[model samples]
Target: MTAEIDRRSILQVIGIGGGIAFLAGCGAGRTEPAQTEGTSAGISFRDQQGRTITFERPVTSVVTIPMPAASLLVAVDGGADHLAAMHNASWVAMRDGILGTMFPQALELPHEIATQDFTPNVESVRALNPDVVIQWSDAQLVAPLENAGLKVIGLVNNGKQEDVDAWIAMFSAMLGKPERATEIKDHSDRELAEVKELAAGRSGPGPSILYFNRFVGGLKAAAAKTYNDFYIKLIGGSNPATGEDPLPGTGMVGLDVEQVLSWDPEVILLGNFDGAMPQDVYDDPVWKNVAAVRSRRVYKVPLGGYRWDPPGQESPLMWHWLGDIAFPQEQSGLRGKTTDYYRMLYNYRPTNADLDRILWTEQNRQSADYQQFNAG
Candidate 1:
């Protein structure tokens, strides 16, 4: 909760006050006037599933059943003032990370809409009287909420870079905050462009990386065309798990020790799920032969406002961090970029220790703070 200047500077550069005027001057003929606070014409737009939805008026109250939906809403809507309730996953992620630190008021909101397994409770959602409900594109889950007479907007979050722009556009239109959406989109575009430019300077193929969450049940990796694979490609690294068929609807494919050894990835990125630590990988005898472990290139993905593995507001930050890790010789300005993003978006100026906490690695997993954050 310390980076107001960074946020102000972003606004100043974007000319936020004149953003609408600039759009008007673009000469892009529109079919309808943009929705505003009290427009009688109401709001209408197509959601991610290609369903046309029209509202009688601008939405002031919202309930999000998916964690990413809440994260995107918070980014475009500024804070959680409009959120009536959220999924339990979103509640926990926000409570323990930069989102809660910056917007403590969000902690006071109710989170009784769904359970950890994503089972929605209709009665609990009805009690909140939300203007709309945002969730995944699952028909069965969404049908019940719609039957309860709530406006339901379905989004398919596949974690691609394109999904980021789509979320910004969808939420901006729904909340009647096009200006904020433009600002967020512009910021993401600028950061990603810089990272892409850095990648262009590389003379050879990037390192091979494998991103996985758990190793107990089986080795599940982010396969090609999935959300996590999108990040791997963005960082200029290649995913060895690509081309293999992913588990149905899960976007992950199974791997065995022998298969992993064959791929011989130079880097391994452990997802910040289930309190996984890099030490867990290093200690396993079967993994000792992997090139990543031998070279000490294994690292834990960072978790800030949200987990970096998925498409959320903090994705651009992840791009910068991964680029620097993959090719340090290019100097991707990782620290400066991370500091600016935290200040501008989360309104929190990270101290050196705070940076360490956000970018928790295997070396610091035993610290009291890291333990507390992952204790859940």
Candidate 2:
């Protein structure tokens, strides 16, 4: 068992901030170092943030700070045996999703290495003696851990589909299992190509869909360069929020009731980052008049190994789910595809009830489009 660190007690003195310390490997168009006897020989790879990371010893244990990195590791490495600690949100996602059931040890791993917003708790991280820590590119988040003598493989904080692919590629390379990433990418590529063909065949432009990034405290919609925007456009749907500009340091923009009313999207998507649901949209008096709410087009994004909303291993599934809703004419067997994916990735087939939970079948059952995904 890993020793527990007093995370709350140590933060005051630990002094944390962010920066990636480049250890070894070529820099910007430089030639790869020749394999020499005395130096330039170790586990070396460039992280997604384009920083080169090299370790003299094998990475037997890892601390994944980014929310989805932990699950990505489990998928790429084929188990959670190498995980030392992960972010709290990552732990929660695992606990609630199928990964926790498949790799129970991960649920017991500590999440005290980083705080709620991914700030590194330097002392807490040091206690675990992880071989490497997967971190984000935020300077405040990476600097502190580097100062504490931890090696960070920095990844960018973005929701693009390529970013998800980059994560799989980077992690699999780091684990000395590059083939795993190739397999994952191949599956994703095949599905993405299929979805694109379906989109091209659609007769008219798809419905206008609005993605609520946050609806509990205030309304924020995904717009421009977000992964939501990528898929919304891919599935033949147009983002009504395309013109809504995002404020600095975020990918989404703010809105109010009247603003949303003006757009009057044909479909509304509630993200998995919060607890807001389709029922919440349906129950709201002010929202009752909206075309999507009135038509029961609002839906809560599904959660499987991770929340299928943002970006992760199950994006192909998310694309199909969204496509089915926005263009039911092209609906396929999502339940069977999900079963096949699980068998290939986790080596375990989900039960009908598991599929229901993963697909949000019960909560979304009211929507006619959701019935096609039901297992039973």
Candidate 3:
């Protein structure tokens, strides 16, 4: 069942912002420590913006402004010990979800720094006295933090698999744990290889998927070049909205009810952001005619240490789960793989109840535990 298609080649062909080639290995060489005033050790790497950044010493104390970045920090560092502060969103997920279940100590860490919306409070961050600040690669955001005399590193996780690998490598180097980075990358590569094999077994075109983000004024769908869109492609699912142009900068497009009906996707995946659930879609009159709803093929994307739909350390596990959802007959061992992943990475074997919560299964949807977990 091994895929004849080279995974890296396929990724480049479908890469966002045109085909950016996947690097063969970690780029940006390291250099000897120079006599810089503040830096104890010298390390350099290329960031997502293709800018080279050098650190004086290993980033021991960190403030991750973005929720996803917090997850990455904890994962690559092998624990939450180095995290001085993190976005509130990651803290919430950690408290009520599998993160807390695995690493209860993370609950004790200070996560009061308010930067979940990408707006950093300099006073609040300065109080934490972090050695480095990790956030999304936005110049405007980086400038003010620099002005405040804080060392900041920018990262972009736009759903490209190669980029995720690069991030693991870059963060590992920054944390002075190149061995850990290699371990993480090797695990991810192995998992992706498994997914490719499963995808190769499928006969016809994969299921037509629509990743519904929210139901605000209209249906906001993940468009081409978006993270969710890239995930769909990675898992061998076809996005019905691919032909439509993405919204400027954001990579999400708004689709009216009629347009969604016209696309009539075979499978619908609800994003974990908004509180919208499968019941809402099933109950809506306009949505009733959609093929996915009519066939009972709509599913809620799982949320664990982080949202499975986003770019994070849990992406390998995400690929396994999505592969099962996309081709259950061929990739039916998601639970076993999930068990191995949690045990290996988080050092906690999830209970049956935890699996239900993480998977967002129908049984979980009917239970009070799920309600309480979401309410928190």
- Best-matching candidate per TM-score: 2
Q: What is the C-alpha RMSD of each candidate to the true structure, in Å?
A: 8.2, 8.6, 8.5
Taking the tens digit of each residue's C-alpha lDDT, what string does model 1 give over 210-282? 8886566677777655667777777789887773433333466676778888888888887765566777778
Lowest lDDT sum, 10 consecutive residues, model 1, at 1-10
TM-score of 3: 0.81
**What TM-score would every model get versus the actual structure?**
0.81, 0.86, 0.81
lDDT, residue 244, candidate 1: 48
Across 247-280, the per-residue lDDT of candidate 2 in tens digits comes to 3333677778898888888999998777888888
The lDDT for every candidate, in the order shown, is 0.67, 0.76, 0.68
Q: Name the runs in model 3 displaced over 4 angstroms.
A: 1-42, 108-116, 216-218, 244-250, 363-376
Models ranked on lDDT: 2, 3, 1
Query: Clashing residue pairs, candidate 1?
Result: none
What lDDT tens digits, residue by residue, belong to model 3 across residues 271-328?
A: 7767677787787787888888887777778888778877777888777666666665
How many backbone clashes does every candidate have? 0, 7, 0
